[model samples]
Target chain A: MRKKANPFFYLFLVVFVFFVMFPFLWMLLSSIKPLSELFGDKAFTPFSSHPTFQSYVSVFVDYPFMRYLWNSAVVSTITTVYTVIVASFAAYAIARLQFKGKTFILGIVLSVSMFPQIATISPIYIFLKNIGLTNSYLGLIIPYTTFALPLSIWLLVTFYRKIPGDLEEAAKMDGATLMQTYWKVIMPLAVPGMFTTAILVFIAAWNEFLFALTINTDTNYKTVPVGIAMFQGQFTIPWGEISAATVVVTVPLVIMVLIFQRRIVSGLTSGSVKE
Target chain B: MKNSGMEGQAGVELNKQDARLPVKKAPKRERQKKESRAALYLVAPAMILIFIVAVWPVLQSFYYSLFDLRLSDPKKSEVHLKYSVDLGRYLDNYPFLISSIDSEIKKGNDAAELQDIKEKLQSLDEKLQKDPKVKSQYNAVNDKLMNFKQPSEDIRFADVEKSTAEEFSKTTESVSSQLNKAAKKTEFTQEKKLLGLASGMKDSIIKPTFIGLKHYKEDLTEPRMWRALGNTLTFTVISVAAELVLGLAIALLINKAFFGRGLIRASILIPWAIPTAVSAMMWSFLYDGQNGIVAKLFESVGIVDKMSNLLTTSTGAMFSVIFTDVWKTTPYMSLLLLAGLQTIPSSLYEAASIDGAGKWKQFTNVTLPLLKSSILVALLFRTLDAFRVFDLIYVLTGGGPANSTETISILAYKVMFSQTNFGEGSALSVIVFLCVAVISMLFIKFLGRDLLNDGNGAGR
Candidate 1:
């Protein structure tokens, strides 16, 4: 049986959760407030006298936010799919096969993940410009996959290592080919790991800013993060529209976190803790 | 009798099987080879993509650091191997300038000065056309100029000897400046055209600008780069240190079986889960000078004299950014520590209690010692990330309030993209990479050694 928690523990927990959730709560409240209430003299009021969806409507109407959302979806979805497929192949090789230079390859992935994106920005911009690939979905997707590969492969490798070797051995004994064994036996069990990797990579791609800002100058190709950042009016910022945009982009991610909290936690720790 | 006979027959069969073992081993070796090849095949796609997307770009950036590349100037936009001429540019303006000079002389005003300038220009043009290839290209360019058609880039440029390029550039510059001065003494119909065309021709004398190490030298001497780096260091150190302490406390609290543990754990991830850019925008609102809740709280609590001070003052801006970063990332730090906490056996705390040790004593002896590696890992990740902070500062402040919050990454972005100075920008990028490499090296050398020592201790 667990020991009874101390009274101070509850007090500390309350403070901790309050600190953690305060900004989010503030953002939510700001999003629903009408402009007059938001910028009024008594803006410090906890809630608006009248709650409205005007900011949300204005976000979609004032800018091409729907287009930006579509762009982010297209780029992020493709990046997630490609990153998973590519990382899975390599992760399987490293985890299951005995190969030369495996340690060297793993080291490369680790070091590359630590590479600062700023270092590669200029060259990648010049390269994409030369090849006429800038402002296109492929341009952003390529770098996103490169940056996400190392983490995706690392997490999947740990996951692959924990599966019983006997399963694959049994499949091979039953006259299954290598592809058949992986597809029919190994992959079915690795779905949870793959889902975790996909979610992490999708969030990364959706949230990446430097590349999105550098690669696409056209308004039509801007992702939500870049587009939202570029929301400036003549004299001051449109905080209402920005807050609405933030809520729109962030709610989906929060929902994903709610649905896959355990998987995300495991994936994060496995990649970092070296267990 | 039957068993003895079967044994003798089995002995003969065993001898035959042993003789065929070499043949079977050869196929096994080949199978192993095939498997290795398959492994290579499986990893090839990812490896090749990484080389293209990650490795090649770094190499390209390194290559660009060796030149004086600026996109604003036409001559310096691309790398030049040798002295070359924009013959079309020269021809487009040189002939018109000569005719305008002819008209000036025809007006019989400052005829001697005009004649001297015309002779110099004619000689420079002749020197440029001295090379046979250049002569051919020059004639083609003149024809295109006469026809009022723009010359293609390939046909407009031709390589020249270094001496010829120097001589032509000097002559054109001298002539252009002289024409400007001479025009001051006269009021002629073609004075404006003459000066305009002459100045235009001065830029047409393309000279090679391959200044290796110049960008690096400038960046190394510039105070702004160092200041940006100092700001980054300040942010990294303070924010990481704060997160470490707070994260440990949270990890200790949650390590025990608590009611609603799952809900608390998930809620903690909300700040970390939000995109950094989005959260930065949220903080910008919370730190807004006019109507920010945090600013109001700070003002009311006497943290600042005014609400706008949080973002408008340099120290306050730094404090605000670091505090926001700590708030967003402490959960991540706590989560990592929580994983470490779970690994520590409950028996240690129980044993401590049996020995009559207090909570603080038990933490110092058991928890801190065991949690070192996790703390090291978390610090390393956060340090590297905070050092390379770009999106947060970029969106929230644009490194504003006189660039008090600018980091090296923001400076590099401003140089490379906004100012379009790729050479200096690439040098800054290389500097940032070197700093990061040093930081990682220091972490691995020190922290990794501790981890090793702990492993050996455990083994003993």
Candidate 2:
């Protein structure tokens, strides 16, 4: 039988949980409360509001939120698709191909991962303006690919290298070109890395704010983060509308993670801090 | 498995190309050459894209810094000019001609030529106010005029860099006086200042040039640059310290098996997974002071009976940001340390227990040293990240309650973007890059080989 828990651990656990969970719970609470109850001196509770979907209703009816959601989905999905595809083929090349400058390419890709996105933001902004990519989905897609590629390529390379070359050599000896060898032999083994790269890229694409904020000026194509951030208009802070929008935006990721926690954790750990 | 030889590791030791020697076994020379070409072709997509997307923009940013182009423009006069400069660069470009002049003033060799250029420039400025093209050119010229002059040793040559920084705040200070005030500051009247001004002026006669030691020289002189460095140092120390202590506490608590352990674990990851900007925005809303939970908690805890907000005052605002950052990021630190904790192989604990070691003894002797690499990893990442934190502060406070929370990154953004001072921004970016590189180098050198090899012995 489990004995009484360490009091020290228990006390610390309570404080930790309170600190972590308080904001989320408060978000839920504040979302329901009507404007009047939210403003009052008394402490607010999740159920304090008049139990209304009025905030949710207003968010959809009032703003082009659905359009924003669509735009975000379109851009992030395109980014994920390109990152995975490009990173996979390229990763396959680096890991398997004994091509010239192979190590040089790997080191350059690795260094690119560490370069601060902020330093390059101004230059990219100017370049995009020249190419007429600014204020467009293509603008976001191109840069997002750039941002996501290094991580995608790194993760894929790690996993690809983990696979044995014997599998590909067998295919190669059996009358396969290197392209066919990669597609037929090694690609199937790299499923885990591919999925991991796709999901992480999706997350990065969804989470990107700086580019979405500055590059895109119009509301028609705003991402969820930018949309909710600039939600405040001419007069009052639309707390209700903004909160509802956040809940809607956050729900998909929360659900996706809850359903696929194993994959995401493996993806995140390997794709970032570890091999 | 002999990766040391087969795996691709380039020799950085050789600055030039490595001399390739022939290997004994080759399947077919003709086929091998074709395959090599194919391999280059295969990797070409990623290589080209990486170049276009990643390195190209930086090259573009550097090149743009050389010319003068302000985005707040509508255009034409060869599209841009090099006449505009900034204080730091002017200070950098000392013995440089013509610091701060009227928008109408243009660069010339002597005072008489300078006056003629000034008249022509003034006429251009008035026209610019009306014409979009002229206005764009005018703003470009104006920025150059206000920022060009540097302090020189000779009496006639010294053009005080007047403060145009507060000009957007001040309506009365014309571009010319701004230059004078900056030039007149005899505070930098030292030998190093004279040399820096002289060297910087000569480096670029037309555009701003680097005085090799000007940035360093200004580090001793300029208050704003020094303030930014101080801010970066302060932010790094406080944030990392708080994160470490708090993260360790949480990791220890969660290490013990408990009810709702899985739920709590997942719940903790929630904060980490939520994007930094989103979390910052969420805290900003909750920290809305007038109706914030922070105010409510303060009242509830008996700290302040009057339910006051924490963001209205400068210190309070700073605390509010720190508190939110700690709450959100401590999980990342814990996760890493927890990973390290897992690697400890509880057999050590079992052995300690058998030896009759106490819990404190086991933790101190058994766990602490074992946990070193991961702790360093966590510390390195957090410290570097904290030093350059931009998004969180940008979202929450915009570096305010009077610039109290402005870190180096935010200060760089303002100088580079908001003020359109490319030279200063470029200098700032280079400094930030160096600082990050230095930290990484220190971590690698001191933390042993963990920087390159992840603790898990996979690659080897």
Best of the candidates, lDDT: 1
Give the alpha carbon lDDT tens digit for every residue of B130-195 in model 1: 788989988888888889899888988898888888887788889988878887887767777888
What TM-score number comes out for model 1?
0.90
In candidate 2, which residue ranges exceed 4 Å CA deviation?
A: A1-15, A42-46, A96-104, A164-166, A169-177, A271-275, B1-39, B66-69, B73-221, B256-261, B299-309, B352-357, B447-460
* Cα interface RMSD of each candidate: 7.9, 5.6
- Tens-digit lDDT track of model 1 for A1-275: 33578888888889888888888887788888988877857578878889999999999998999999999999999999988999999988877666788777877776677788988888888888889999999989977866888878877877776666666755654667778888998899999999998888888888899999999989999998899888877789888888898889878877877888998888888755534
What lDDT does candidate 2 reach at residue A180?
Answer: 80
lDDT to native, each model: 0.83, 0.65
In DockQ terms, which candidate is top?
Answer: 1
Best by TM-score: 1
The TM-scores, one per candidate, come to 0.90, 0.73
